[model samples]
Target chain A: MLNPPEHQVAGHDARLGGLGPLADGSGRFFKPLQSCSRGDNELSFYTSFSSDPRVPPSVRRRFFPSFHGTQLLPASDSSGPKPHLVLQDLTSQFTRPSIIDFKIGSRTWPPSSPSDYIDKCFKKDRETTSLTLGFRVSGLQIHESGDAYYKPSRDEIRSYGHDDVRRIVRRFVSDSGLASAVYGGSDGILAQLLELKSWFEDQTIYHFYSASVMVMYDKEGVENGRSGPAVKLVDFAHVVEGDGVIDHNFLGGLCSLIKFVSEVLTDPDGEGEGRRMKAKKGGTENGK
Target chain B: MLNPPEHQVAGHDARLGGLGPLADGSGRFFKPLQSCSRGDNELSFYTSFSSDPRVPPSVRRRFFPSFHGTQLLPASDSSGPKPHLVLQDLTSQFTRPSIIDFKIGSRTWPPSSPSDYIDKCFKKDRETTSLTLGFRVSGLQIHESGDAYYKPSRDEIRSYGHDDVRRIVRRFVSDSGLASAVYGGSDGILAQLLELKSWFEDQTIYHFYSASVMVMYDKEGVENGRSGPAVKLVDFAHVVEGDGVIDHNFLGGLCSLIKFVSEVLTDPDGEGEGRRMKAKKGGTENGK
Candidate 1:
């Protein structure tokens, strides 16, 4: 049975209310809903594919719908502020070093299925595939009490497929690759890589603070259940502005910053420092 | 004794005119003197110890001296534009990767020597110490006509010192020790340790930059040197800046960027984005 009282899981499925009063085929809805989170509480937003017979298979949250709500921690608790996210990449042997968290304005979505696109693209077994893209937008909002707020909690992640996103990721990876080469086959290379990784991860998360959709890797579990390496693509998108395109106000330099960062990160050998670097053995290249 | 005029070794030095005026404690003289070089048509900026007697060096020129001239590159040669400086870390095995070259603005102390304090503090081994932080700073001239003009090649190199140079190096190493402790020692600790090393190297380089001192290290020879690792510090505090503190402007941000970059390049598992990441030997620390 599905979870009851949909509101309880609002953090998981945001579209629980479904399409409200569609005006016509033009894709405009007559009834609009608005929700706000408060400073005193933590907010979580989530969505899961539903199996309701009335909904179509192509849509995520078909039966259950997405949810959003604020979480109240015990007032007596001390530890300062609670970290927003805790993502554990099952493949990594090292422990989760820190929480992956960020604040956002508001969230909008399309909620469509895209097969195992994410896993296929980043496949490690030397599989060649076309690059796929995806995106999410979360809106920024001002609370009734005059506080500024961003949507979508830190834990929930969204991916984008736009050429911009692809270009950005590609550049980042390339820069990182050059950096790796410069470090050569030394232990120092590893340290450099770690700091870079932290920077990239942190920067990516920071973009989410505005209205940027994050990059996500599907956790390995389903196919064999026993768990191996394969990751599936999760269906989700975030909207910061009215449409999928982020307004300059919310995500002004985020895309460009992401691009610059990726370019810097991918070139490991210091090749991008106005020069091209040669690749090392076993350094595989993906993406056309 | 110091390789008089006509008998200079081929790769040792050269003399160029139009270096403007030379200033000393006594007075200013406008004379063209012969200079030395390790390579043909190469210029350098370096530091030296003023007090030491065996190499009891006299100030070659003032610290961070300025040269007022223009350099002309063929623009046809594929090597890109030649930098006003061709710096290297004589103490270390590898040359600095990022700073291949740079430009010297007007109002420079034409033929001042690099600071001697830098060399005294940076000891390579117990017995054989580097006399001066040797390097070349070529490509000198005065701009004439429009954007393009004939500039007399006035190339000179000198050395000077600062009391705080050694203290800065020690402080950097100390800070690195603290930073490494924060992230070292765990299952993949070896790998992590390597990462921290890169971070430290970058941080060290960055600190030097902020001090307005251009320090370079042999990337390839750090570990193989006579000391724990091979690195060199060159004092350019005397180089005259037309508008502001040129050394700090070039060194500060660069050092930070280099450190940040070096750390990223050394990442072992590529920032934990793949399937076999779980096979990383150590179990994941989910709670943290």
Candidate 2:
């Protein structure tokens, strides 16, 4: 049988206690995005990359300055009622799903009793703003086994493929301007805070983990070196911690850091424009 | 944005894995019919309840004699060139998909090396089987998430639920009976001896794990409880040794066990017949 596997990737990395519920610690805390396994933590923070290949060197470099080693101060001067509402807007950009969980510090290992375990769990939860999130996302491109699983009979004209799905999602993101909106818009506040913490906590981690199940035919012509496309999801769960949990002062500061990072990542136009101009100048200079 | 999940459950576990090439190994391997947790590995086994409620007592007592640690030897005692085969026929008796794995020891944590990890994983897989086989099967229900992962979308409606899919497959198997005929109507046979040994030695340790996402809905007559008429597979993945290698012997043995288990699980007339009869009599006498 030419059954191929589909790929799927799912997990959530949320900030603990950061987005407390309006009433009773029940507010939804995280949003989720697709992921895969290509790094240390199976999830990664952005350094930089060029989406378009036509950008010129010097101009691109200026527009896309490296923030690889940059770190943001946890506490900020921005605070109070008039505190930057920009933080709220930026949170929406950090749209991966969030979960409420406690981190186990080394000191709490091997709790003395059940009550101790609960106490440890609760205390750790209170002191930790960075939470370990669990969310699963999987992708399947085809039904391969003949013995019977999810495969529709010959009558069902299913034509699912990973590339097709990716194209469709990406196309939708590009066409609807969601990426830009998320990058440039001021409504993703909750998301921004979570994203900021995730990146800050996992400075050394890169790449993401994902699984896919695809029929052989669906993967045709794609440069995927993998033999078959079978859908599967790899879950990435992690503990994220900040400089402090009780300090509300640093919230705005984290938001600002995220904004700076976001600008560099999403300013496709700025760097893209610079590169085009530089290429034109270079070409003319060479011609002379 | 009501992008209802891409898949839904089809109520019947055994009914899934019917997508053939489309349903191939992705969803099938990921579902461990016994439990839903990814961390806990459970064997793939099926359960069938009697239509007559009166027979509960007898059915409970002996319907599953195997539950009392019945040792299921290789299909036959023959020592000739014939290899053992466990063939199971698809039927309407089961509502869930079952697993067939192997175990040789207790679960050890934090495997020290690559080989240790593989050995532990294999033993855990086998242990699950041993436990399931020895205990009276409880919490035996179909997995709805298995159906959802495999369900077809409106844009791809040719996809049907697990029940409908199984019906088609059973019909196909009934009509063809080719695999059975090849073994002279015996349960699955060792297709080849060489393949079996190589299968065993060639086996790679895979940290196999699976979980199903169920869409639960309330049953019409049942209060407080829910009934899932549909199921779709949600997530599945594995970690194995040898880069991409697998032990052919273990796999072959597993396949045989699955086929055999399916046959016995579905066959009410098999060893479970006497117990079922007694249960019916007891229930009728007691007006239960």
Standalone chain B TM-score for every prediction? 0.23, 0.25
lDDT of each: 0.24, 0.24
lDDT of 1 by residue, B1-288 (tens): 111122111112323322211222222111122234321211222322222232212121212222332243311222334323222213222232211111221112221225353234222211111111111222222122233322222222112111122122222223223213222223122233243323322221121121122222222232244222212223343433111001222221223223322332343322432222234325553211
Best by TM-score: 1
Instruction: Kindly list the per-residue Cα lDDT of model 2 for residues A1-288, writing each as its tens digit.
Output: 101111111122112222111111222111122223223221232222223243344323421222222222221212212111011111121112111111111112121125665466435422322111111112212322332223222222123221222232223223323444332333342243344333322221121111111111122212132221111112222222211111111221232223332433355434532454456566332111
lDDT of 2 by residue, B40-106 (tens): 2221121221232422443233211111111222211122122111111111123332211122111
lDDT of 1 by residue, A180-255 (tens): 3322223222333333333322221211222232221112221222322111111123321111111211121222
**Can you tell me which runs of candidate 2 are displaced by over 4 Å?**
A1-288, B1-238, B243-288
Q: Give every candidate's TM-score on chain A.
A: 0.24, 0.21
Candidate 1 segments exceeding 4 Å error? A1-137, A145-288, B1-70, B73-288
TM-scores for every candidate against the unseen true structure: 0.21, 0.18
Question: lDDT (0-100) at residue B253 of candidate 2?
Answer: 27
